[model samples]
Target: MSTLEIRDLHVAVEDKEILRGVNLTVNSGQTHAIMGPNGSGKSTLAYAIAGHPKYTVTGGRVLLDGVDLLELSVDERARAGLFLAMQYPVEVPGVSVSNFLRSAVTAVRGEAPKLREFAKDLKNGMDALSIDPAFAQRNLNEGFSGGEKKRHEILQMELLNPKIAVLDETDSGLDVDALRVVSEGINRFRATGDTGVLLITHYTRILRYVKPDFVHVFAGGRIVEAGGPELADKLEAEGYEQYTKASA
Candidate 1:
């Protein structure tokens, strides 16, 4: 089975450290949820692992199935089966959704998918996510609702089928109905048993629909608490007050 290991990861942005020696491991077929207060460095961990230029890894290593991921560029990481669903998806003015997805698949797979084959796959993914077929021709994330943008992110995950997926605050702006749809897509992805998911969120709403195999509490830039699903329930009841206090 594939594995994504984070060994004492340290990330800094603009000469200021955010993630402080964080360590976690996600195995294929497992879903690990990261919940924390704002500014606790949860997103920093995601961006660092995804190789974002803004977040610099000052020390430690990120390995994917034994390969040094911290050594790879962002696109190389994607090709190496690492996917990150950003908290804020950017708008592409001219790139159509279908074209963008096809190009992404081409990039990851190292070759273009045939028109007929790719068309069928696209249709299935969109239909499953309840997206309108006509929107495929629209510009990516341009004038789309928050829920629509998040669904598009999940759509990419479905098509790319990465070995490891890090979703950063995907449930942030979604309403109840939208939350259910996105959660279902996450469940579908988890069912594949070949992709490990590191889901980051501020609350436990999404966890109700997609149960995490493990729940981690992030505070003061590192994970201070880790446990089974019960930990989520505990966090929901008690909040991060204790952890934040302890970390401080």
Candidate 2:
């Protein structure tokens, strides 16, 4: 089984400290949720693990199956079974969705897949996410609605089949129907029992649909509380006020 270990991570953006001594571990067959208020550095933790250049890792290490990921480039991290679905997916004006996915699969697999086989797999993933076949020809996220963009991210996670997937605020801006579809995709991924998921969000609505094995509360740029799934219920009931106050 694969394991992603984050050890006392310290991250900064524009030389301003963000994450402070954040520590967590996710193993295959498990899902961990990171919950927090706005500006609690939740997204920073995700970007840092994904090796975003803007978020500098000032201290500690991120290891996937014992290999230090902080030492690898952004694309290299994906090849090592680490995937990051950004909170705000950028629009690629010219690249079609199919082309973008194919390139990503090629990079991660170190070779290209046969056209016929890739086509079949792509169709199946889109079908699962309720994505329109016409979307394959559209520019990547260029005009996709919030729900569509999030669904596309899920499609990528399925195709790439990473050992660990970091979903950063994927639940944001999704309506009820879209939320269910996205949650189902996440549930489908974890059901394989071969991937670990680190779902970062401010609300626990997604958790109700895709339950996590562990829940962490973030405040003041670090995880201040942690527990089982029940912790999420507490957060939903009481909000982040208690945790934020404690951190302050």
Tally clashing residue pairs in candidate 1.
0
Q: Which segments of model 1 are wrong by more than 4 Å?
A: none
RMSD of each: 0.7, 0.7
Q: Mark the 10 consecutive residues where model 2 has the least summed lDDT.
A: 239-248
TM-score of each: 0.99, 0.99
- Tens-place lDDT digits, model 2, residues 117-235: 99999999999999999999999999999999999999999999999999999999999999999999999999999899999999899998999999999999999999999999898
Q: Please report, in order, the local distance difference test score of every candidate based on alpha carbons.
A: 0.95, 0.95
| Tens-digit lDDT string for candidate 1 (62-151) | 999999999898999999999999899999899999889999999999999999999999999999999999889999999999999999
Instruction: Give the range where candidate 1 is weakest over 10 consecutive residues by summed lDDT.
Output: 239-248
